[model samples]
Target chain A: MPVFPRFTALAESLPPTVPFVGPEAQERTRGARFIARLGANESGFGPAPSVIEAMEQQAGLSWRYGDPENHDLRERLGAHLGLAPDRIVVGEGIDGLLGLIVRLIVEPGTPVVTSLGAYPTFNFHVAGFGGRLVGVPYRDDHEDLDGLLAAVKRENAPLVYLSNPDNPMGTWHSAAAISRFAAALPETTLLVLDEAYSETAPVSALPDIAALADMPNVLRFRTFSKAYGLAGQRIGYVFGNRETVSRFDRVRNHFGVNRLGQVAALAAIEDQAWLSHVIALVVASRDQIGDIVRGHGLKPLPSATNFVAIDCGGDGARARTIMDGLVSRGVFIRMPGVAPLNRCIRVSTGPEVEIDIFEQALVEVMAELNGL
Target chain B: MPVFPRFTALAESLPPTVPFVGPEAQERTRGARFIARLGANESGFGPAPSVIEAMEQQAGLSWRYGDPENHDLRERLGAHLGLAPDRIVVGEGIDGLLGLIVRLIVEPGTPVVTSLGAYPTFNFHVAGFGGRLVGVPYRDDHEDLDGLLAAVKRENAPLVYLSNPDNPMGTWHSAAAISRFAAALPETTLLVLDEAYSETAPVSALPDIAALADMPNVLRFRTFSKAYGLAGQRIGYVFGNRETVSRFDRVRNHFGVNRLGQVAALAAIEDQAWLSHVIALVVASRDQIGDIVRGHGLKPLPSATNFVAIDCGGDGARARTIMDGLVSRGVFIRMPGVAPLNRCIRVSTGPEVEIDIFEQALVEVMAELNGL
Candidate 1:
């Protein structure tokens, strides 16, 4: 039968695709479960004991919708960040929030700027809204900030995205560099400063809340999914000038944020001691992963994020083989999607037991793939 | 202090208004919590005990993202509905899914049809996507199916929304009449047959799964939120022709649904005995609400859904006064937004304790407002 004949031209033109193939999908396709799940950059360390307790206590309250305004969590986040609640908007996740921001600025054929392979989910959102994406290839394994600014100016792009303590490549730029980049952009350009990894990054890497807090065009995105170990809860928030953040109120699914997510985030925020403990483990886990990969004859990149992206000697080909070999042996890891960065594989930090499994799996997979 | 300079014209033109003010927001403003929590139509009776147990059991697993495919839930739902898994797409909520479906078909200036004073969140999404909404007025407090069909034909609307066992007035048309309505629309018009109240509805009020399952132009939206009492879990699913269902995969936040929500829903679906228990309680609660309204010389609309809409024997102003009185006295209830429908106040069914509070509060509110 013919399909419903009138989907929008843009929706029609778009392909049926997902931004990432989750590990569960791979297990189904390959007919085996991965004992070690280090892909997807989820915090395998798990949420804090207090967050779990909060979720447990409120498990029966699933009958009530979450506070539509996400009132308490937003208030706490505002106080924590030294900003007013009006400046922050919590959402389902950074992925869901990114889609809303794209919808607000991107009409069909509008130009948007981002690095070639910084964050595919952001690009997926841009494409979903029919925005024309201009991807500046990474420079020195870091997002090409100057190049992104140049593209935005040339195209008069109203939207651009940059991730500090960047993903996939696991590299970062100094706070001063990012602050300068934000200043260089025309006020007409909205910059999505994704800081999903901010909790794990060096103190010098994140800008002070006041530095760009008043910039109407800058919205810094943060997530409890990362260092806070609540990826499964789908809680993330963005903040900027009150008026700019207010634009989201017009378009957001007001009750879209999950209920237990609010509980998890509130508990996670209050349990900063657990977060500090996790950050310490993450640093040590990164070094252990670096050592393991180095033993396998690959070079580990310096990382400010939870994951370490290691160069696998050859290119995307070798990285793919190693990744496939690891998966076949019940280890799940990921690699960057494009060239240069694609020569590396990324492994997320977790408890020592999972890291130990990854370390053993890597030795065998490297031997099998590289014919050691 | 100017706003972000380059939001799309449509975005800038849209008001920074949420479709519904949550009771939480109301409490925040009123500086007192409502003792009776019945405003948003959420199930105050809560989910199955098994569902709560499941959530608590998996509470620690929430550090991982939910399966992007929503694989296990879809498989179970497919079995329950007697359809292939590909026919179902699970999402954050029916609200979020409505946003996606509207985005797929409703480009700027696209004509969309809905009943006047229907789901405001759906209309919010239509306006967010720049669609022109053409609303057909309700007939005798039930959505005018014939009017909606005619409007779709008149405007050549690609999308139309109807909530069976309707909200606000809580009335429903017979299954045969609804099936005929779906059959009469041009194959081009996609019908969002929201069945959030299906579990509470009489068997005669629901079309069998096979009747509309093959129609590419028809999609039925069901939720764990309403009858299953998992409103806070934010899990809803749409099922139809496989091809149309697949369209959602293209735009949905694949990992957007929360982890524990999946566990909660899976458990809720399995515990049909508890569902029957809730439905029985809802029927009694509905009768209780009806009796209370009638005692006050108001008319309670006959309802197939879990809520009763009580007519205050006057106009919108009188109903608003009655509603405000109830809310001020810690009785949370909502009235329909548009005129005609606005003469009635809506109350959701809940546990006996909350129903008793509603009953007592209604008497006091009426006496205070109407000098009864």
Candidate 2:
């Protein structure tokens, strides 16, 4: 069958691909469920009991469309963040919000800056909008702040993405260093500071809200998918200067955010105790993963996020072989897409049972690789 | 506070406004909630008990991110629609899907055609993408198929939108008429056939799936939001020739659909009995509305949708008075934005109790207007 031939050149140029192939897709292909789902950094610990109850209680109310403005949730989030509600815009997810931000700022040939192997979804959005990406390489497994700033300056890029407590490598910079980097950026540059893992990070790794609230060029993206454990809900928000944040309103599907997600996110916020419990479990899981990798003579990178990146003492090819072995054994995990970073396999902190599976799979995979 | 100055010219040109102000926003402003929510055409009858049960059952598993590929839901939908899975693409909602289709085809200065007063969300997306819209006015109360075809040919537009069993006016064309309209459109023009109200319409109002199945340029959009009563879940899908449907994958937020929504939609599809019940109730409610309007000396347009568009036998100002009076009396309702259509007020078919409130309120409002 012939495809409709009028899609814009930009749309036609984009490869029909997802940034990450979900574990569900893999299960269908493999014809078996993964014994461990540590690939997507989802909180396998599950949502709070209170949140589940709230969802159950309100599931019948799913007949009404969600409040297009996301009023109550935004009001609560405003109270939580110490900013006015206007400063925040709730969206389907951080990925969806990233796409909107890119659409607002990027035109064909527009320059965007980010770490070479940073969040692939952000890059996907930039490319979707026909933006030219200028990637700065990570230094020492950390998103190099100086390198990103230099590239922004060199390319005069309007948009730059920085994920503190970054993904893939599971690394972070102190809040002070991040604040310095934000302060050094040109006013013309819009910084997308993703803090999806903020709840799992040390308190000092996140900047004071006041430090960046005044800057129109910086929008911080956060979500309930990590420590709060509502990844399937698809609720994420972006906040900054009201003006910068309001740009989302112009193009967003006003009723796009699902109803139960708002209910779950609101309930999750009210259950801070549950979040603290999840964070504690995450810390223990991280330590357990560190020990497990060290026992196999691998180096585990210190992480502030909900996952650990363990160096396999080899290159990307070796990491791929180990990852493949684990996958064949029904253990799901991921690795960075680029060279040095790809040498490290990433595993999410989750329930001890799932982590046990990961540990067992890692041992057998390592033994098999040693034999080879 | 300073606004971010680096947004693209197109983004800067667009206004920050919602296509429709939700009843929740109005209630917030009014400092009171509407006792009867007949606006926005949401089913106050609510979702199926089975769907609610399914959501409750899966509430705890929300910790895992939704299947990014929407594999299972798409598979079930494909079976339901008698199409191959590759021909269907699910997204956040039909609204979200509409935005994606517009983005895929529309670019700066691209000419797009649609009914002048049809779904505002579609228009919002066109303007967001900097596409110039050529709106053909409605003929009588229904979308003018011939007028739209003329506009498409005149502008050499690459895209056109048609919502069967139309909104605001609650009128429709026969399936034969719609099929002919699709066949007549240029192959270069992609037709976004929104069937959001399909389940509520007469059997003859919808073309057989096979009627337009082979046309790459015809993509039919449907949702669980209306007769299925899953509006708040935000799940909608589009299907067409495999090659055409696949384009959505290139630009969509792969993980945008929520977890419970997928479950709810799956269960809703299984509960055909409940859907039949809702449709019967909607029919009764529509008749109830028609009677109520006629008793008040108003004209209710013949409807194939889950709403009644009642003409007040006056102009837009008179209709506004009646609508505002109903809202003030806590009976939420809406009207079309443009001319002759605006002479009518739209009320969604909902539960009998809400319709009771609407009837009482309309009686009082009309009496007051007459006295004035």
Question: How many clashes in each structure?
Answer: 0, 0
In the range A302-360, model 2's lDDT, one tens digit per residue, is 99999999999999999999999999899999999998799989999989999999888
Off by over 4 Å in 2: none
lDDT of 2 by residue, B1-372 (tens): 777889999989998777999989999999999999999888999999989989999999999888988888889999998998988999988999999999999998999999978899999999999999998899988899999999999999999999999987889999999999999999999999999999999999999998898899999999999999999999999998888888999989988999899999999999999999999999999999999899989999999999999998889999999999999999999999988889999999999899999999988998899895
So what's the TM-score on candidate 2?
0.99
Task: Give the proportion of true interface contacts each model preserves, from 0 to 1.
Answer: 0.91, 0.97
i-RMS for every candidate = 0.9, 0.9
Tell me the docking grade of candidate 2: high
What are the per-residue Cα lDDT tens digits for candidate 1 across B207-243? 9999999999999999999989888989999999988
Error of 1 at B82 (Å): 0.8
Q: RMSD in angstroms, candidate 2?
A: 1.0
Residue pairs in steric clash, candidate 1?
none
